[model samples]
Target: MFKPAEGPVRLPSGQRYLGLDLGSKTIGLALSDTGHRIASPYQTLARKKFSADAAELQRIVAKEGVAALVLGLPVNMDGTEGPRCQATRAFARNISQLMPLPIALWDERMSTMAVQRMMTDEADLSRARRAELVDKLAASYILQSYLDWVGGQPT
Candidate 1:
């Protein structure tokens, strides 16, 4: 019953959204407040078998009362999709079969880089510390961006 979301995601009151940043070795997770105004870093899941990953996600969705998902879609600076985009889409398709929720693909160009820069320049975190936090923080940024966009949409 899961399908790609085409526009602003409308959620029921008291429900939340989950944001994801999929990497080769890990998947970063973020959660939105029930009001859908703020996104906070949740946790990072190490990449494993697809079934295991999806199961973990399902558990989070149920526990968090998540109503939908906002998954980062990495695109080139020139706005062209490449292998990474394809992989993300494939993951979405696979996960949808298991979880019935709307999935919005948000352009994630430079999201990681932006997070890295903020951690290094503003936070002044060591490389090890940044490495530990960047993925989840990037997920937060992606989710915040989506929420902001949704807020601006016509009611």
Candidate 2:
């Protein structure tokens, strides 16, 4: 189902969408319901390689009936794009070639830092536990933000 996209994905109702926090060594995953109202942490995929990661994600997308992707774009704080942003865009391009679904890049500035702060200050989690939860939690944060924006937009 790897369809090429012209731009960012426009999410439709009654279809699940997967959110991703793509790290160099791991990929965090979150899933929105058919209604696209609630998003929850789905999994943290350990990166072995691009093809393998995409294949696993493809399987999950098919299994979950996911209609699109919401990828966290790591933008810089000064409202400027940097190497990480460029790398993410390239990753999106490569992934777009592999999957037909639209990949929306959500501004993910401080998503990880926010997640870490929440885990440490609010959850009172240990460093090891925080390490385990941060990625997926960050993915959830990204998805939730996107869902809120989508809900706010006029139909």
Highest lDDT model number? 1
Per-residue error (Å), model 2, residue 137: 0.5
The Cα RMSD of model 2 versus the native structure comes to 2.5
Q: What local lDDT score does residue 101 receive in model 2, on the 0 to 100 scale?
A: 78
TM-scores, all models, native as reference: 0.97, 0.92
Candidate 2 lDDT by residue in tens digits, 1-75: 333344445666767889999998899999998888899999999998789988999999999999899989899
Candidate 1 lDDT over residue span 1-155, tens digit each: 44578899978779999999999999999999999999999999999999999999999999999989999999999999999999999999999888888999999999999999999899999999999998899999999999999999998
Where is model 1 poorest over a 10-residue stretch in terms of lDDT?
1-10
What residue pairs clash in candidate 2, if any at all?
1-100, 2-99, 2-100, 3-100
